[model samples]
Target: MNMSDILANKVVVVTGASSGIGRAIAIRAAEHGARAVIVSDVTEAPREGGEPTAAVIEALGVTARFVKADVSKRTDNDALVAAAEDLGGVDVFVANAGITLRTDGADVPEEDYRRLMSVNLDGPLFGAQAAARSMKAKGKAGSIVLMASMGGLVGAGITVAYSTSKGGVVLMAKSLADALGPDGIRVNAVAPGTIDTELLRTAAGIAEASEGFRKRTPLRRLGQPSEIGDAVAYLGSDLSSYVTGHALTVDGGLLAVI
Candidate 1:
């Protein structure tokens, strides 16, 4: 069981990789020995103020390139996967781009709701579609990792649109797994709870609410981007060859007590 080079020689595509959990996932893929890491996002600049994700990954002695993409657009997803062909096609596609809207079902604006759903839900769906098609065309049994949320599994009035979208992501993974299984393509998801990221820090009621998140989690602390990164790396690697249609939770036991 020498699993040291888990994702070794794999070409991994990660979306929304400019910052946060997406950035960490791309970096971890390279660290895990991926042949090429495709850092796809609307921009290359990091939101938390650091070097771009591609540069950070390249520093790990791995092939890394920044591919500008808006995952919400189907064409962008297709182009992103096509870009992976330059590196001999994608071996793993991590649909990690997502957003949250703090609005209830009744109060969410139409424009805001559409944008949120397009990015949070349609992004992953289209990404998976394109990636799966590429994998099938290449006759490769690739892995697809969708980013779900703890909100997906549980209901919350504050995150109505967000939770609904992620809940779709959860079922989407399972449905995709079942459909793509015959083709040897594996589909799964990662459900993360409150993580310490720039996005979370900037949320409303930051200081007090962060403490509340900590208290609710069994681990008594917010999860880290790297933790989710490691989990996704596992899902993308050979270590999870037999795992599919599953939602791996990296929430520090937050859902356990809930």
Candidate 2:
């Protein structure tokens, strides 16, 4: 089947799409023919060139809307769902918003822990819930893809809170899949190894040993957002009708090697 026709006339919502992996997924979804793409972030206002990803989607012939909503905030999550409903209906919801921070037990503030949990862990949970509600209400039988990391799958150094938060997301996705499956809503998670996004540049060890990730990763380089986008597209499309409650790793074989 032609990939471009996979998502024709479907509506997709992507969070954290101001840049990075979220942006890549949004653009690719539109390219595959999603009727309307909601480019969500934490900023208000929209523009023709409001976002790099949305710009490309519009250029490729799809209606893209920008909605500013902080994933951590319940009201924001609601608004995101409302935005999609306003556009018509949502067939895919990409829970791609997240934040990262590092701190030792001694120096870590309670607020820091709270903030990370709110975004990394809690955000996806609430987003999935909202999407489920929308899908159930509309009887849309949709797809929801949660973004996770190697941190979620394995222990990384020093960032205990960040690692734990993503781990929660992994389970959250599975739980949603199990519960939503009866309603025909497929839920999945994408755990990418290391990518060249702005988030990776600021990550603790990645920037310090840029070459280390390359050498350690079997591919001998960082993963790309476009690669993750392809995986997301598959999961969101009919191609993955039988796939649910799975953590699809896009780590370039990093997890395969010792």
Candidate 3:
């Protein structure tokens, strides 16, 4: 039950970790005694406008490295994992980088759709592939967690591309789990709903949607970034040894009702 027991000595790599849910995940993993936490993102600055994630983690006296990576590219993802391997083999990889645009199915532009697929879908796919390869090469057992969304589970009127990409991520996790199980590599996805983060605040019509999300949720409030971080930590730890190919929903009971 101690924080150190959860991820003690583990090497964790998290993409899109400069802010929001990803930043929280990196911080929590370090707090749980991860030996090395590699933060891979396009920038070091926090999107919500505060201290950089690496600085905060270093301030905690944890070994943290910030590697600039654009998750949309497979080469970038590969390099990101390589950076983590330099410290130690990656014991846990969280494919958390993603982007969302507010547009209906009919109004979605070709360029926008491609960008969504590249970042939201292909990012996890390539990241998992690279991480799995590294773990297998090192003859190590590892865990891979993909960031999914409630939109992937249900149809949302305004997020056509985003929903589709996330839906792909959900199933991709399952497929990867099946493929990597033989290598003792576990794969899973976390579907978060309405977490109060910079990403959600900047989403189109979030103000209007926030009230609806609160009213529909049994918890009557938005989930916090750290809540999602806790879920990732659990999935990455031995506590979830028997769990894989599953989409853990942390939605404040919103999905339970629907």
Candidate 4:
């Protein structure tokens, strides 16, 4: 069977689908033939693939819906699972919601640190819990992919709490993989390096020379949101049935510290 159709008839939910990696994953997941595509995020504005994402999925002749909710809230996470169940239950979940700290060491305010932790750390934890519960109760196999960062695996110059939160997500996926494996649920993570997403452009300190910095990588280029989308599709699809508890780096060899 074609890999594009690996997710055929499967229902998937993607958090932070308003833009960046989450939006790309949603679109690619629909392209992969997921029967139902549910997108969730805190914002209501026109994201790159907001209505367009739903439209594309519906064009593929599948079901698609967008929900506005703050992923940091436990109730909101439960609501996402509820929406999936309302649409017929979930087979895959992409916890792509995250935020970056705009300030460096001393400039990073304590309140900002707390806000970032709420969304980047607590959000994914609650998401994994909700998705795992839904999948476990279904008595069938499922997949959960969380968004980590190259910083999570190592460390960045000024990531501070952002790195810490992603580090938490990376370990969370591993722990979940170990805990939910016997139940047929596979958990994994995607750690992106420098990508040409709007988020990267607006990220705390790495915006100005992102393109130049991307070129300095061994690959002589930066990655793209679409690349991460493809990776998410793999983890979310049956194609990766045997892959779990691993953080697949999608950077252009930026993590290759030789």
Candidate 5:
């Protein structure tokens, strides 16, 4: 199949797509020929400043619909799926909405922790629930991609809450894959390392990763949002039909040494 036809005729729903990694995933999926791209997020504005995700995807000659959704809310997630059904039953759902704190593990506040978990942990859970139900109802074999982080695999003292939430996501993929496998719904995750997004820049207290931090990776550089987008595209496409319950790490080999 041609590269662009990998997801031809598919309808993809991506949360947190107003900016950062989620935006890239939506755009990449459209570039790969998704029939419709459901761009869902809490708001329509991009945090990094650019055209809305739906507009960008539409410019690529793909159908795009903007759905304002908070993945942490079950109703919102269900509504997102409903919007996808208007085009066609969801073929892939990318639960990429998440957040992190700038504090180290020990000093996180209670309110901060709760808010973080709601967005990071509960968001994907609700998204998976809504997407799975839609896919099963439509009798379509669909893919679910959760966003995980490098800290999920290894203990990161700096971002403990974020890591803890993503660890749950990693296991969530495995558990969901087992439960949904018989129904032909595949579940997977993509764990990224220090991608150069506005979120990372704000969290790291800089415009980009420190040169010392960059050198620590085997690739000797930070990852890009588009690189994570590519990995997610693989999981959402027929290229990874047999792949499920797997966490594809796209950290520029940062996990190799650490």
Candidate 6:
């Protein structure tokens, strides 16, 4: 099979598919000839502005569906998985929905922290559970890709809650891989560093810190969302069949110096 067809005929479900990294992943799956690509998110509109992810996929002559879902809720996650199973069994699940707060650790508000954890941490936990259950019931080995962040491995002075939540996701992937391995399900995470997403551009102090961020990285640049998508596609495909519990970093070499 061709490299682009790594996920041919597979059913893929992506959370936060409305935009940014999630949108890129869903589109890439369709490019890989996925039988059905389910785009799950709180909204159908793209955050950075453009056609909805499902529309983009369909325009590519691939099967795609949009399922409105709030990943923090278990019911929503389960329903999203069911929707994917309806199209075809889910062969790959990308838990890419996440949020962040830009407050200093000492001044972080309770509500902000809770909200961040709910989406960033709880989202992946529920998504992984639902996808694993479906794969197990169908008697198929599958892949689950959780979205972690470079913040999780390192530290960000003002992003206490966001960093903590991503850290939980990294470990969650590891623990799930251990528990699900016996059942033939693989779990992993992609940690992106300073991706050029709208969210990052609008992040507090990011504009002022951009130069410093670039200078510290060996690549001397920010990563693109599509770059992270490519990493996720690899983890979710047979190319990395023997890989599990690994956190693939898609950073532009930022972590190397840090």
The per-residue C-alpha lDDT of model 3 at residue 86 equals: 73
Candidate 4 per-residue lDDT over residues 101-180, each given as its tens digit: 76845457899889999999899889989998999888869999999988888866688788888999999999989999
Rank candidates, TM-score, best first: 3, 6, 1, 5, 4, 2
lDDT of all predictions, in order shown? Answer: 0.90, 0.84, 0.90, 0.84, 0.89, 0.89
Write model 1 residue lDDT over 129-211, tens digit each, in one string: 99999999989999999999988999766777888999999999999999999999999999999999998987654434777
Give the higher-lDDT candidate: 2 or 5. 5
Query: What lDDT is obtained when candidate 2 is compared to the true structure?
Result: 0.84
Candidate 1 structure, TM-score to reference:
0.96
Ranking by lDDT: 3, 1, 6, 5, 4, 2
Which residue ranges in model 5 land beyond 4 Å of their true spot? 1-3, 204-210
TM-score of 5: 0.95
lDDT of 6: 0.89
lDDT of 3 by residue, 174-229 (tens): 99999999999999999999899977877786656887998999999999999999
- Score residue 74 of candidate 2 by CA lDDT: 84
For every model shown, the clashing-pair count is 0, 0, 0, 1, 0, 0
Q: Give the alpha carbon lDDT tens digit for every residue of 1-258 in model 2.
A: 225868877899999987888888888898777888999987532222354666777888789988888999888998888888867778999999887775633456889989989998888988888888999998888999999988789886666777788888889889989999999999999999888877677666557766776798888889888889888888999989999999999988988998
lDDT of 6 at 11: 93
Write one digit per residue (lDDT tens) for candidate 5, span 9-82: 99999999999999999998998888999998889999999899999888888899999998888899999999
lDDT of 3: 0.90
The true-versus-predicted C-alpha distance at residue 150 of model 5, in Å, is 0.5
Clashing pairs in 2: none
**lDDT of candidate 6 at residue 183, scale 0 to 100:** 93
lDDT score at residue 215, model 5, on the 0-100 scale: 87
TM-score of each: 0.96, 0.92, 0.97, 0.93, 0.95, 0.96
Lowest lDDT sum, 10 consecutive residues, model 5, at 204-213
